[model samples]
Target: MNDIENRLKAIDFFCSGGGMSYGMLKAGIDILAGIDIDMSCKDTYEANVKNAQFIHADVFDLREDELERKMNLTKNDNNLVLIGCSPCQFWSIINTDKTKSQKSKSLLIEFSRFVKYFMPGYVVVENVPGVLRCKEESGLSSFISWLTATGYKVHFEVHNVVDYGVPQNRKRFTLIANRVTDINIIPIKQKGEVKKVKDVIGEHNGFPRIEAGHKDKSDFLHTVPRLSDINKKRLKKVSKDGGNRLEFANDPELQLNCFIGKDEAFKDTFGRLWWDKPSPTITTKFFSISNGRFTHPEEDRALSLREGATLQSFPKDYKFIGTNIAAIARMIGNAVPPEYATAIGKAIIKSQKNAI
Candidate 1:
């Protein structure tokens, strides 16, 4: 096929704010549409992803025939790519109320329905490692088995995003299935030093310092959650440049009632990030210093919305649409790192080229 004819068209399911779609576009993929239940993602997805329509609908309610009709998709199209990055909180290893996410556990199964009906040339799935650990419960095992049974070659493994040029040390389970041939998701080997927090964030990286509850004058989204007076005092006592709560352990006023005896447990909570190292996993509560080691290395407050998005490999110009800081943080934290998605897209293209 000629270059124009060989172009791959992709439709991203659960495409929250167009992270994966943006990266695929960066790698020369033609994104046709993004489907998600959250109406908040529509504006952001439509604005940043050129030539792609945003469909606000629950996956459970979306029928294969409806999707085929809406996107004009044909059965067994060799150049069609279906991307699924369903919400993985149910299978995430994080400590949370599982009951809230119980409904999301079956989303992968829902995604498999489209895969079976269309049998697209390429299929991609990205989720947390817990999905593999509890594959049966998450429907991942059956999905892989069905794909392999039907002549699709499948490859899946858990990989850290830092190895794929993302500045954060986020681990994700990735699966790539193709009917034309066996495919692989290769990590981008760094020539020298990998990216560190200092290299991509802080004053050196153009993110000027803004105090807690203050927004950067130039960017309104560069604002952090307000810390209470006690939390502010606690943060002041906590040393700068990657210090922990242990520094204020002896201080009676700074210590919390819940953490009196459990010094070793939950050490990451209310901790500062190391300047020279890659950041810990960014979560939905990354805007709060009480959540993980989200505090800025030298600053007194937690990361801003813009900083959180930056850690997730989003471009500076990418605008987020949300009602509040927490809502925006959830969108940023749950997104696939765009750089890693770009790498995946490139690998698929390389596989296609080799097959030809």
Candidate 2:
């Protein structure tokens, strides 16, 4: 039994579908709430994480006093933990769209305000690594300076999630801070062995094999995107293990216009996933082969929603509560993979204990 007496409370900011909270809770933290601007995440977040209340509000709009009240944080001590994994589309290298949201860059500043108010003993943040490479030093530099001024020792690093036992090859920027002591995340080796796409979902037996765009009647979210017959034929042309759209550059009808002259325009698209390797980073449109290297190793259809969720390390029992495939996919892809969060939580608690 845990001898540490005070309630080990936590609040997750930008906690979509309670992914981070789920893992932290597993590490014995009493998660009080999850805050997000997306109202759609409310159902799934509440459904999966029972004790945590889902608050639908932009973080900037949230007053620190109100947030502290919701967390039931009375004494400011080592028992309180704050987690911030802000939305990171703007900081991502893969998304080069000119129309990306400009407002997302400042969410970290708002996170610092809450830290000042609650004076939590511990904090954890996760984001795309590009956040460290921003043009203005004012962005990340200012946040670090404030943390130091506020008396928190900070450690930030980029880590691949696969090392933390997640079955996908996603790299993220992570930061851990604590006023209680100087600390570092205990580096995690891949537990036992690196898990692959096949290990997570190859044995799942609930649904029958249906073509793309068709859902199993009993399982609504176990669905894949519909492929055109021509695209289906095109998929058949590529080898199962390491094929991509580039292979079809020689074929007139099958070739993509962007890749017709060049051998590879967007090679990851229409690419097959190797069964033994970790899956490529899951994106919001993982259901469509056109989105990423999402095609099943030996199957013609793109990854089903269930397969995508499994690759992201969401528990098999965890249920996402939306009907639209796109919205559900966004929730899964945007999440901090729970297994990775679990390692962070364990590290924080261990570090705190060592300090004592």
Candidate 3:
């Protein structure tokens, strides 16, 4: 094989905080650059990821020719890998406004333009399961049809991120298309290797016990959001570990007005995580107890930024750059779990070795 074909290189689209970039690098894939429009991601992406440049550009406006010129990519490069893990708020099942994601929903179509122009050796996509459920609406069906018709072997499926070694139970749609050989992208871990929350966090895992609103001056990322007086009182009454809001159903004082009549609904809200189980999906609002079962197993506060990042399989020393807690949480929650990405990268490397 020629040097160009022997060397596997990648470019990550919508790479937030360089999760996929860093993970793929761990598997020995050379990352050319990470492209994202969010300027907030630039510092974090550059700070933690070495050898890969961060390109600040909106995919919708970025022309294929410009990308090829900027990256010096050639058409039909068999060693090239193009990954498009676009913003999933539109395809997400979260109760968000439809209007806000109207423009983002068509990102797959935009990404397809690059795939068609470059016809890279491999193409990767990871997003919410809703993208597969609403394939036509999310432009996935069309993209798949095109890939198959163009002689590319394609495989797409919805996978629980926990199955790929992410400590959180996030379900995502993953697709890998290859023009050189049969497509095989999904990574498989050995049975009984699933990780639990206790394995990654808490005092046993080096996270010191801290009260609500405690901020470590040396490591500000370990800071937890402050709890209100009412929330604090309610949390004090709830059980320490794996407690749910249902305990307050009979108590008129602590019961939220929204859940009074609907006692059985939204049980995860204001709930504590189970120590022995994988964590619930970490959302963009994980710092707030009202969001999900985000409360620390023992601590009174919700998961700190560092804790959440750890749960997402980010390395201990990986740094995120953002002042606003909400914005930083969004970056962590939106990321493709680094461990899962590493698995995918390993699978790709295995495929390359097998082909030889």
Candidate with the greatest lDDT versus the true structure: 1
The 0-to-1 C-alpha lDDT of every candidate, in the order given, reads: 0.88, 0.82, 0.87
Candidate 1: tens digits of C-alpha lDDT, residues 248-348: 77789888888898899888888998888988998889998887899889889999999889988899888887778888888899999998999888888
Q: Worst ten-residue run, lDDT, model 3?
A: 183-192
> For model 2, which pairs clash?
none
Q: Which 10 consecutive residues of model 1 have the lowest summed lDDT?
A: 183-192
Off by over 4 Å in 3: 2-5
Report lDDT (Cα) of residue 49, candidate 2. Answer: 87
Model 1's TM-score against the true structure: 0.97
Query: For every model shown, what is its TM-score relative to the native structure?
Result: 0.97, 0.94, 0.97
**Runs in model 1 lying further than 4 Å from the true structure:** 183-190, 216-220
**Once model 3 is optimally superposed onto the true structure by TM-score, how far is the C-alpha of residue 122 displaced, in angstroms?**
0.3
